[model samples]
Structure formats: C-alpha cells, structure tokens
Target: MHLLVCGGTGCRASASDSITESLKERLQEHNLQDEVQVVMTGCFGFCEKGPIVKVLPDNTFYTEVSPEDTREIVEEHLVKGRQVDRLLYQAPEGGRVKDSKHMDFYKKQIRIALRNCGFIDPESIDEYIARDGYFALGTALNEMEPRQVIDQIKESGLRGRGGGGFPAGLKWEFASKNEADQKYVVCNADEGDPGAFMDRSILEGDPHAVLEAMAICGYATGADKGLIYIRAEYPLAIKRLKIAIEQAREYGMLGESIFDSPFNFDIQLRYGAGAFVCGEETALIHSMEGERGEPTFKPPFPAESGYLGKPTNVNNVETYANVPVIINKGADWFSQIGTEKSTGTKVFALAGKVNNVGLIEVPMGTTLREVIFEIGGGIKGGKKFKAVQTGGPSGGCLTEEHLDTPIDFDNLLAVGSMMGSGGMIVLDEDDCMVSVAKFFLEFTVEESCGKCAPCRVGNKRMYELLERITQGKAEKKDLQRLNNMCHVIADTSLCGLGQTAPSPVLSTMKNFWNEYVAHVEDQRCPAGSCKDLMRYEIIPENCVGCTACARKCPVGAITGERKQVHEIDQDKCIKCGACLEACKFDAVTIK
Candidate 1:
C-alpha cells in the first residue's frame, strides 16, 4: 500500500508538506511505516481540490487533505481498510468519486506530457526509472540513427507546445542541416503568460522527461550540449531540474557515451529574470548569451545561429516533455490521437472564473465548450459565461459563439486567437471586456522590451485610449483611433511581443463591441467593473436609515438623520464602495 501526497507548489503552499509528515508519523505510530510507504508526488492537475492524497492499490483519492485529517486517513483508510467518505472528491451530480479516473475533471484529460507528474516522487530518480523514464533515451541512443529519430518526430506531427506551434522535427532538421561544429538544444522554461504554468508544472513534476527529451533532441539535431533557460521565479522547478540533471549524469543516462553509444550530450541551466519578452526564441538565446533580453530580427533563426552563435533548436518545456512519449509509442500511434493536422495532446493551465481551476491536458481538436464546461466544471457561482482568453495576454478573447470551436493551432488562429503556451483564462458576465483589454495592454506595456517604437509608443497610446474609455471621457472617434492603432502596432512591431500586444484590444472590440459602445456613448460600464464609470445610489425603500452606511463612509459621502431615508452626496462620493460593504440593508447599488 502507498499514500501519494501532492508535493506540487500549489499544494505545498497549502501545507501539504506538513500533511506528509503527519501521515508518516501516524503510520509509524501504528507500526505500518514499512507496510505503507508514503510518497510525495508532483501536481495532480486537479488543483481545485488540493492538497490531495491518493491511496494506491485501492485507488482511493482524497481531496483537500489537511494535516489534521491525516490521523483519520491513516486510522480508517490505511489501518482499518475502510474509505474516508468525507475526504473523497464530491462529484457534481452528488455521489463521491472514489478515485481520479471517475472524476469529470480527469475524464477528458489525456495525460501524456504530464504522465509521471502526479504518479512518482520527483526527487527519486529510481522511482522515475521504474516507470520507464529513460527508456526512450536508451532506445534513441541504441536503436535509432539521428536522421531516423528526426523522421519519427516528423511523422508524429508533434508541433512545439510553445506559442508558435512550429513543427518540432522540422526545427531539428534545420539545426541538423547547419554545419556548425558546436550545436545546442535549448528548453524554453520561461513561461511568462499571465495565467500559464504548464512549463513550470512539467519541470517540477517530470524534470527527467524534459532532460531525456533534450538529450534525444541533441542527438537528432547533432547538438552536443543542451541548456534550459528557466526563470529564477521558479525555485522549486529549478531545484528539481538541477537534481534531475545531476542524477541523469550520475546514472550514465546523460554525459558522454550514453547507453554505451557514441552520442555525447549534457545539459546546463540558465536563469531568466522573468522577462515576458524572453519567452520568444531569439530573446531567450540573447538572454542566455549574457545580453539584454531583447528580441532581434529573425532572418538568422535560432536554428541557424543561437546561444553564442551556434545552431540551436529551441522548444518549450511542455514541447520537450512530449518527446519521450512519442519515442516510446510509435509515431503513428501518437499521430492518430488528435486531429489530422494537429496530432497530439496539449497541456493547458485552466485559470480564472472556472470552478475547477488547474492544469489540464486534452487531445487537440477538443472543443472549447468541452474544456470550459465539462473539464473545467463550468463558471464559478453559477455566473453566466462571458469569454475565455486563450494564449495569454497576446492571445485574443473568445466568446460564447466560439465555444464549439475545435482547439488547435489552425482553429484558434482562425478565430483570432493563438495556442500561446496554453493559458486559458475563463471570464464571467460580471467581467468588463473593456477593462480586460486594458489589463492585458497594461501587462504588455510593462513587459515591453522597448526595442521597437510600435510596442513602446503604440501600446502606451492604446492603453491611454482604453483608460479614457473606462473613465467615461472618450468620444466615439477614439474607438476608431484605437482600432486603427491596433492594426498599426500589429503590422509594424518588430517582434511577436509587439505584434500580438494588440490582440486583447482587437479581440474585445470584435467580440464585445456593445460593451465598448456602452463605455463610450452611454458613459457607463455595463459590467460595473470600471470604478470611474460606476455610480453608487441608495435604494430609498431598502434604506432603513440606521446610519451604518453613513458611519462607514470614509469621505462623508452620505447624510441623513436617524430613522429616516439617506441620500448620498454625489460630489463627495469617491466611488470606493465602502458604503456597499457597511450596509446591512443592501441599500447601496452600483449603476
């Protein structure tokens, strides 16, 4: 029997480490420590119910397992051989789900890249090996030639899981064609999207998978060295990656003559300063080479010259995570899983407004409706679904009409969005589209490398236009100017950061034009999200005149005698909504 406790960063923040120790101590008290092994594994993807604990053999899964509950879990479930009904995941339809396999969240998920994540103790290389961890690398080194490996990847149709969705094999072939004496394989772990954590989770949970994949990539592209360009913000992931690399080297899985073959490959780590622009390939290479993290023109692509001017193939962490699986399962088998064009599953960080906010992986061609509704458990608090922002700040906001749209590189792009590192942020009806656009623009503006005038100047101008709209100070002509400027920036920007910086504005304007019109023409925020456009009024009938709101008003915006109706002084009203919170009668309402 085994007890698997979630050791992912999210769960750790919730004191899952204490829960692990408590469980072990309880097992020792019962003299069952040897009988039942306690293991701390990576993320389970179902972050909503973490910190989770799963019992092996019986397949009993527990949700929100606190350290205090560890006693009952060990007593009833471990020792008594009975399940803890209260701790089991409650199904939306009523019954308790015994295990993850039966849960709706995992029903649609196909965990290929996340295969070992929630299953093994990430710190243990032996546990990783037991699960066929380095089998793919061994196979690649022993059986397959360099060109054959590349061809298999091509046949699998595995596109890069990074924003670009470029063909992985084609990139390898490009790097291979270059006659550089020194070549490199770089894993882009600098995931800077607003809600994206796919790359970080993979590294934390399955670092070996990425290391093995990079070695495979090194062989395929004739690259002798690999570098992981990860952000310093990810301490846990960096720690696990360092451990995995050292273990791989110690075990002869990495270093010279791996599997007794002629291939000599090793991996090193490069720390990023969490610059969003560094997510781009050239910018990442530049950062790795001790230069300012700014993007340059791409005539000399990373494949031709990168990382101190060598042939370098750059693929993100999730992209590399899929490599070993493709090698283990035949290319044809992997290719047949998804749509004809995009053949493989994609990992997504499903965040915001959604009830089941967590990491999810689904086959390509899965509808947004299925992911948002079924897998995500619908919008929180039963609020009406408004939109979903895919591909981070750079990707566009998709609406209800696009719910049934198949999710793939081509399909998302066709609907004015991109599969950008798989950050899916769901929005509700209460969310203001205008504000959403402004928020993304603000992020883009702050993160801009300032390499080009279009991104530096144009995005600031666009942000100011949005600010005016939200403040009810913009005319209808400003809308036209904003629209035209979006095109100008997108067309003129030198790099992808500037090019896609206008996506949020363009998408919100396209999908929620009425919201923009309300903000502009009516001088009102439809969602009541913009503070400047909101007016708090007292409902005369609802106000009991107890002076609760008046006492709470910081700026003295309310005035009335006791036991009488109150009125707000609009001139003094700061729109702080303090009265709304202080009122017991619910008299204050935003208009």
Candidate 2:
C-alpha cells in the first residue's frame, strides 16, 4: 500500500512536509513502515483542498490533511482498513467524495501534460523510471529517425503552449533546415503572467519529463545542446530541476551517447530575474546571452539564429511536458483528443473569485462555461459572474455572452482573447471593469522593456487615461482617445509585449462600455471599487448616536454627542471604510 502525499509548492507552504513526517512516524510506531510506503508526490491540481493525502489500491483521497490528522489516517484508514469520512472531500451538493476520480473538479480534467504529477515521487528517479519516464527518449533514439520524430509531432498537431499557439513540429522543421554546426533547444520557464503557475507546477512535479522532452527536441531539430531559461523566483522548481538534471546525467540519460545511440545531447540552466518581457523568444534568447532582456526585429527568428547566434528552438515548459506523451501514445491517438487544429489538452491556472482555485487541464474545445462553472465550482460567495480574463495581461476580458464559446486558439482569438500561457482569472460583479483594465496596465507598464516607443510612451499614456476614468475625473472625449490609442500601440509596438499591452483596455472598453461611461459622465463607480469616486455618508435614521463611528473615525471624519445624531465631515473623510466597521448601528454608507 502506498500513501501519496502532495509535495507541490502550495502544499509545502501549508506544512505538507510535516504531515509526511508525521505519517512516517505513525507507520514506524505500528511497525508497518515496510508494509506501507510513504511517498511525497507533486501537485494534485486540486489546490483548494490541498495538503492532500491519497491511499493507493483503494484510491481513498483525503483533503486538507494536517500533521495532527496523520495519526487518524494511519490508525483508522491504514491499520483498521476503514476510511476517514471527515477528511474526505465533501461535494458541493451533499455527500463526501472518497477519491479524485469522483470529484467534480477532476471530472472534466484530462491531465496529459500533468500525467506524472501527483502520481510519482519527484525526487526519486527510480520512481519516475517505473512509470515509463525515459522510455520516449529511448524509443526516439533506438527506433525512429530524427526526421520521423519531427513528422510524428507534426501529425499530432501539437501547438506551442506558451502564448502564441505556433505549431511545434513546424518550429522544429525550421530549426532543422538551418545548417548550424552548433544548435540549441531552449525551454522557456519564465512564466510571468499575473496568476499563471502552469509552468512552475510542471517543473516542480515532473522535472524529468521536461529534461527528456528537451533531449528529444534536440534530436528532432539537430540541436546538440539544450538550455532551460527559468525565473529565480521559483526556488522549489529550480531545486527539483537541478536534482532531475543530476540524476539524468548519473543515469546516462543526458550525457554523451544515450541508449547506445550516437545522439549527444545535454542541458544547462539559465536564471531569469522575473522579467515579464523575457517570456518572448527573442528577449529570452538575449537574456540568456547576458544582454539587456529586450527584443529585436524578428526577420531572423529564433529558429534561424538565437542564443549566441545559433539555430535555436524555444518552447515553454508545459509545451515540452507534452512531448513524451505524444511519442508514447501514437500521434493519431493524441490528435484525436482535441480539435483538429489544436490536438491536445491545455493546462491552466484557474484563480480569482472561483471557489475551486487551482491548476486544471482540459482538452481543447471545452467551453469556458464548463471550466468556470462545472470545474471551477462557480463564483465564490454566490456572487454574480462578471467576466473572466484569459491569457494574462496580453489576453482580453470575456463576459457572460462568451461563456459558451469553445476554448481554442481560433475561438478565443475570434472573441478578442488569446490562449496565452493559460492564466484564467475569474471576476465577480463586485469587481470594476475599468479598474481591472488599469490593474493589468499597471503591470504591463512596470514590466515594459522600453525598447519600443509605442510600448514605453503609448502604454503610459493609456494607463493615465484609465487612471483618470477610474478616479471619476475624465470627460466623454477621453473614452474615444483611450480607444484610439489602444489600436495605435497595438499596431506600432515592437514585440508581443507592446502589441498586446493594450488588450485589457480594449477588451474592457468593448465589453463594459457602460461602466467606463459611468465613471466618466456620471462621475460614479458602479462597482464602488475606485476609492476616489466613493464618498462615505452617515445615515441619519440608522445612527443611534452611540458615538462608535465618531470614536472609530481615524481622521475624525465623524462627530456626535452620546445621544444625538452623528454627522460626517466629508472633507476630512478618506473613504477608508473605517467608520463603517466601527459603527455597530450601520450608520455609515458609501455614496
């Protein structure tokens, strides 16, 4: 019997390591250590009920497993052969879900890229091998030629999971056509989206999968060396990747000749300073080469010249994670899973107002309604769903009307959004659309490389326009100016960063035009999110003259005698909501 514990970064932060040790101690006390092996695996994708524990053979899954609960898990579940009802995941409607297969969160998910995650102990190469880890590399080296491998990838129709949904096989073919004595394969692990962790979780849980895929890519593109450009912010992923690399080299999977074949491929690591612009290929290559992480014109694409001027092929971590699976299952089988154009599952970091916040993978053509409602368990606190921002800052905001829209490269683009790195942030009715646009613009403005004037100057001007509208200080003409500037920056920007920088503004203006007009013409914020547009008033009838509001006012904005009606000095009020919290009689209200 195996006791699988979630060791992903999220669980670790919640003290899953202590839980694992506690479980081991309990097993040792019962002298059942040998009988029941305790293994720490990667993320289970259900982060909402994390620090999870699953008992194999029976497939009994436990949610929010704390260190104190390990004793009960071992005693009742393991020793007595009974299940722990309290720890099991309770369904939204009623009964408890005993395992992941039955949970609504896992029902729609088809985890191809995240196959090994939550199943194997990541630190142990032996565990990885037992699960057919390096078998794809062996098959590629022994049976298939380089061209044949590339052809199979093309047949599978796997597109890049990074931001651009470029064909993976076509990229390899381009790199292969280039005659460079030294060629390279680069895995872009610099995931800088606001709510995205798809790449980080894959690296932390299944680091070897990426290494093996890079080696396979090296063979397909005639690249002898591979480099992984990952951010230094991801310490856990970095540690596991280093461990995986060392294990692969020691096991003869990465060094000189592999599987007794003459293909010599090895991988090295390059650290990024968490620059969002480096998510682009040319900027990433420039950063790897120790230059200012800025992008140049793309006539000489990374396929033709990259990383010290060699033929280099770049794909994100999630994109590479899908490679071995495509090799194992035939291209026909893989291609049959999703749509004809996008033939594979995509991993997404589902965050924001959703109840079941976590990492999710679903086949292409799945509707946004299904992912947001069924898989995500609807909005938190029963709030009305406002919008969902896909593709991070580069993508657009989708509304209720677009809920039934099929999620794919073409479909999302048709609706004014992109499938960028799979960051899905769900918003509720309480969220202000104009504020949301400004928030993303703030991030883009801060992270801009300043290489192009359109991104540098144009984005700042656009951000200022959003700021004025949100502050209830803009006229109706500013709305048209903001709209016109969005197209200008998008058309004239040097790289993807500048080109897509205006997406949030354009999307919100298109979808929530009334909200923007409210801020401008009425000088009011419908969502009450913008502080400058809100004013706190003391309701005369509701005030009991208890002086609680007066005592709690930080800036002395409210004043009243013990038994008289209280009055609010609007000039002194900061709109901090402190008076509202302090008033027990509900005297304060926002206008």
Candidate 3:
C-alpha cells in the first residue's frame, strides 16, 4: 500500500508538511511504517481538496485532511482494512466524492501536459523511473533516429502552450535543419502572467519531467547543452529542478552518453530577475547571454539566431513536459486526445471566484461550461458568473456570452482573448469589470520592459485613464482616448509584450461596456468597488451600536456613544475594508 502526500507549493502553505510528518508518526505508531510507503508526491490537481492523502493500489482518495486525521487514517484504514469515507473527497452535491477511478476528478481530465504531476514523488528519481519517466529517452536513444523523433512530434500537431501556439515540431525542425557546433535547448519557466502558475506548478511538481524532455530535445536537435530560464521568485521549483538535474547527472540519464548512447547533454538554470516581458523568446535568450531582459523583433527568431547567436530552440515548461509522453505513447495517440488544431490537454490553475480552486488539466476543446462548472464546481457562494479571464494580463476577458465557446488557440483568439500562458481567473458579478481591466493594465505598466514607447508610455497613459475613470475624475471622452491609444499600442509595439497590453481594456470594454458606462455616466460604481465613488454607512435599525464596528474600524471612522447608532466619518475612512470584515451586524456598506 502507498500513501501519497501532497508536496506542492499551495498545499505546503497550508501545513501539508506537518500532515506528512504526522502521517509518518501515525504509521510508525501503528507498526505499519514498513508495510505502507508514506510517499511525498507532487501536486494532486485537486488543490481545493488538499492537503490530500491518496492511498494507492485501491486509489482511495482523501481530501482536506488535517494532521490529526493522520492517526485515524493509519489506525482505521491501514490496521483495520477499512476506508475513511468521511475524509474522502466531497462531491459538488455534498455527498462523498468517489474513490473509484471512474468517479475521480482526474477521470474527466486528459493529463498529457500534466501526466507526471500528481503521480510521482517529485524529489525522488526512482519513483519517477518506476512510472516509465526516462523510458522515452531510452527509446529515443536506442530505437529512433533524431529525424524520426522530430517527425513523431510533427505528426502530433503539438504547438507551444506558451501563448504563441507556434508548432513545436516546426521550431525543432528549424533548429535541426540548421547545423551548428554549439546549439542550445532552453526551457522558458519565466511565468510572469497574473494568476498563472501552470508552468510553475509543473516545474515544482514534476521538475524531472521537464528535465527528461529537455534531454530528449537535446538529442533531437543535436544540442549538448540546455538552460532553464526560471524566475528567481520560484525558489521551490528551482530547488526541485536543481535536485532533479543533479540526480539525472548521477544516474547517467542526463549527463554523458545516456543509456550508453552516443549523446551527452546537460542543463543549467538561468535566473530571471522577475521581468514579465522576459517570457518572450528573444528576451529570455538575451537574459541567458548576460544582457538586459528585453525582446527584439522576430523573423531571425530564436530557432535560427538565438542565445549567443547560435541555433537555439526554446519551449516553455508545459511544452517540454509533453515530450516524454509523445515519445513513449506515440504522437498519433496524443493527437487523438484534443481537437484537430490543439492536440492534447492543457494544465490550468483555476483561480479567482471559482468554487473549486485548484489545478485542472482538461482537453483542448472542452467547453468553458465544463471547466467552470463540471470540474470547477461552479462559482463560490452561488454568485453569478460574470466572466472568465484566460491568458493572464495579456489575455482578454470572456463574458457569459462566450462561456459556451470551446477553448483552443484559434477559438480564444476569435473572441478577442489569446491563450496567454493558461491563467484562467474567474470573475463574479461583485467584481467591477472596470477595476479588473485597470488591475491588468497596472501589471503591464509595471512589468513592461520599456523596450519601446508604445508599451512604456502608452500603457502608463492607458492606466492613468483607467485610474481617472475609476476615481470619477475623467469624462467619457477619456474612454475614447484609451481605446484609440490601445489600437496604436497594439500596432506599434515591438514584441508581444507591448502589442498585447491593450487586450484587457479592449476585452472588458467589449463585454462589460455597461459597467464602464455606469461608472462614467452616473458617477457610480455599480459593484461598489471604487472607493472614491463609495461611502460607508451604518443603518440605524441594523446597528445596535454594540461598539463592535467602531472597535474594528482601524481608521477611527466609526463614531457613536455606547448603544446609540454610529456613523462612519467619510473623510477618515480609508476603505481598508476592516470594518466590513469585522461587522457581524451587517451595518457597514458601500454606496
């Protein structure tokens, strides 16, 4: 019997480490330590149901278990051969979530991009090997030629999952087609998208998956050296990747002739200084070469002239993770999974106002309804779903009108949203659309590499217009100016960083124009999110003047004597939301 404990970053925050240790202690106490393997595994995509403890052989899935439950789990399940049904995942309808394979959330997910994520103990090389981790590399070395490997990927129709949707095989063919003494394979782990951790989690949960895939790429493109351009903020992913690389080197899987083949390749980690624009291929190459992180015009794309003017191929973490799967199972098998254009499943960290918040890997053509409802379990608190934003800060918002649309590269673009690194942020009716647009604009303004005036100045100007509108200081004419500027920025920007900056504004305006109009025409934020246009008030009947709201007010804005009605001083209230959070009387409100 095996017990897999979640060791992903999100679960780690919720004290999953304590749970793992406690489970071990319980196993030892019950004398089941040797019989049962308490394995620390990568993220189980059902993060909302973690810290998860999944018992294998039976696949008895347990969710939201505390350290205390560890004792009961060990005693009852391990000792008595009975399952802890209560600890099992709860379905959306409130009954127990199924333990059987058919009923699991993973049943609905086609995990091509996330094949090894939840299955393997990321830190251990043996566990990765047990699950056929390096089999593809072995097969590639002994059985297939370099050209054949590239052909399999080409036949798979696999495109880069990193927003651009460029064909993976085409990119590899470009590099392979050229002959160079010193070529390089790069993994773009510089995930700077707002609410996007698809790549980050893959690196954290299955670092070896990428490492192995990079080795495969090295063999395919005849590159001896590889580099991973990961952000410095992802210390956990970096640490795991470092361990995986060292382990691969030791095992003769990564360094020197792997599987005794005539190939020697190794990967080095490159730390990105947290620049959002550096996710671009050219900018990533520049950073790797010890230069400033900024993108140059493509055409002499990274496949041809890249990384010290050598032939280089770059694929984001998600793209590389798919390599082993394609090689082992065959590209024809992968091509059958998703739609014709977008083959295989995609891993997404479903976040924001969704009911079930976690990582999800669904087929490419799955409708937004299935993602937001069937898998996500719908919006939280029964709030109406206003929109779902895919593709991070650069991607635009999709409203209920577009919810039925199938999710793929072309389909998303047709609706004004691009696949920007798989950050799907669900917004509710309570969330002000104008504010949402402004927030993304702010991120772009801050993260812009300042390579061109369009992104540097134009984005800041657009943000200023959004700020003015939100603060009730601008006319409707300002909206026109922002829209006009968006077009120019999209057209004039050098790289994708500047070109896609206007997406949030354009998408929000297209879908939620009413909210923007209401804010501008009536000088009222319907969502009550704009602090400048809102005033907090305490209703006399609702307030018992219990001094609760007053005491909770951090700004000393609430004033009343004992049991009398209290009033909020508008000037003093900074709208930190402390009073609202503390209020049990339902007295505090924003206009």
What lDDT does the true structure give each of the candidates? Answer: 0.92, 0.92, 0.88
Model 3 steric clash pairs: none
TM of each candidate vs. truth: 0.83, 0.84, 0.81
Cα distance off (Å), candidate 2, residue 288: 0.7
Give lDDT tens digits, candidate 1, residues 421-470: 99999999899999999999999999999989999999999999999999
Model 2 weakest lDDT span, ten residues long:
42-51
lDDT of 2 by residue, 1-591 (tens): 999998865567789999999999999999999999999996665555778899998888899889999999989999999899999999889899887778766656898999989888889899989989999999999999999999999999999999899999999999999998999999999999999999999999989999999999999999989999999999999999999999999999998988889999999999999999999999999999999999999979999999899999999999899999999998999999888888899999999998778998999989898888767766776678999999999999999999999899999999999999999999999999999999999999999999899999999999998999988889999999999999999999999999999998899999999999999999999998999999988888888899888888889878788889999887898888988898888777898
Off by over 4 Å in 3: 1-106, 538-553, 556-567, 576-589
**C-alpha RMSD of candidate 2:** 8.0
Best by TM-score: 2
Higher-TM-score candidate of 1 and 2: 2
Question: Per-candidate RMSD vs. true structure?
Answer: 8.1, 8.0, 7.9
Per-residue C-alpha lDDT of model 3 across residues 308-350, encoded as one tens digit per residue: 9999999999999999999999998999988999998888889
